[model samples]
Target: MIAEPHLPAELATLLPPSLHALCVTRRHDQGDRLFATGARPAHMFFISEGEVVLERASPHGAATVLQRARRGFVGEASLQAARYHCDARVLAASRITRVPVIAMRTALASDAAFAMRWVAMLNAEVRRLRLQCERLTLHRVQDRVLHLLDTEGERGRYPVPAGLKSLAGELGVTHEALYRALAALEKTGRLERQEGALLRVAL
Candidate 1:
């Protein structure tokens, strides 16, 4: 048995034993490219620590963050695709486990339990993406910011250890707009920005 400490706790327990030998763990620094758009999918990445974002660039050269993964898998949809649709970039210094895509697909075909868990994980991500879509439709930055705190926070506190710039991308807003919204909210006592988190003030 591979020691639990060797892999992320989530993967150590979730990945089937047959695929264990094929997993490799590595440390990635911020700004490192894990994979690029149009590249063949080679590995499924599990974020053991820190963060990564799936990003795409438009023809005009503007970049958009499609997904931000702090834990669990990034680019789950890549499992079925011939090539990656977006670039996976390390958003922070991170520890990651890479599982060979071929081995993972084989395990899914042969192991019913692991396959079911993978489906459930994808379902949860779908729900988060839905919420993100709804947030993007709101016109006000404060409204979107509040919605994030309401949905994703624990006990009305959302940690921003990665800082507001990262949170801005997640909220689908520019950092300048996010800063303005937060400032207005703080002045109105609508929220409090602590050392590393945002706390929604009780009504």
Candidate 2:
């Protein structure tokens, strides 16, 4: 698993004891439809294990993966304005903590340290999304793929079997096209496909 460097211990501690203590778990495929299109939000989630994919559907019915959340990461967009901006799906069996928005808001108001850490976390997420947008605008698919590997680091290898289609869709490319681009990169020694759908960057 990739280490979450940006999560702050203090922030976790500051969460309401009730929220921090709640236990929620589901099979790998469950919770895939927790959020309906334009669904009103009920609670935010703190993922303790596994990953969740946030996706949005286009008017033409194409689904696009918008983001992925891993352990120690909190999904707070649901707490904002009582409406979810995208659909959330579990990519693997997951343990999550459900935090009521009202409770979270109260805790943040009362805890200065938690508020600061929360702001920092949100800022980091914003920066990451901005970088993704920049990469997606690149003229070449290879460049975009390389940029993703570089940002996610060597351990955050790609071409994951279960998520490849979602990844390609997120990259705005057909799965076949993404595969061809990856093959080209492999031939040039820019990346090596491993046994478990992991792609290691040679650089």
lDDT of 2 by residue, 1-90 (tens): 122323234445646455554423333454555456577766776665556778888889987776776544544766556667778787
List the lowest-lDDT window of 10 residues for candidate 2.
1-10
Q: Pick the candidate with the highest TM-score.
A: 1
* Cα lDDT for residue 90, candidate 1: 88
Q: Which candidate is the best by lDDT?
A: 1
The whole-model lDDT of each prediction reads 0.85, 0.66
Candidate 2: segments with Cα more than 4 A from true spot: 1-19, 23-27, 37-40, 48-51, 55-75, 154-161, 195-197
Q: What is the TM-score of each candidate against the true structure?
A: 0.84, 0.74
Task: Find the 10 residues in a row with the least total lDDT in model 1.
Answer: 1-10
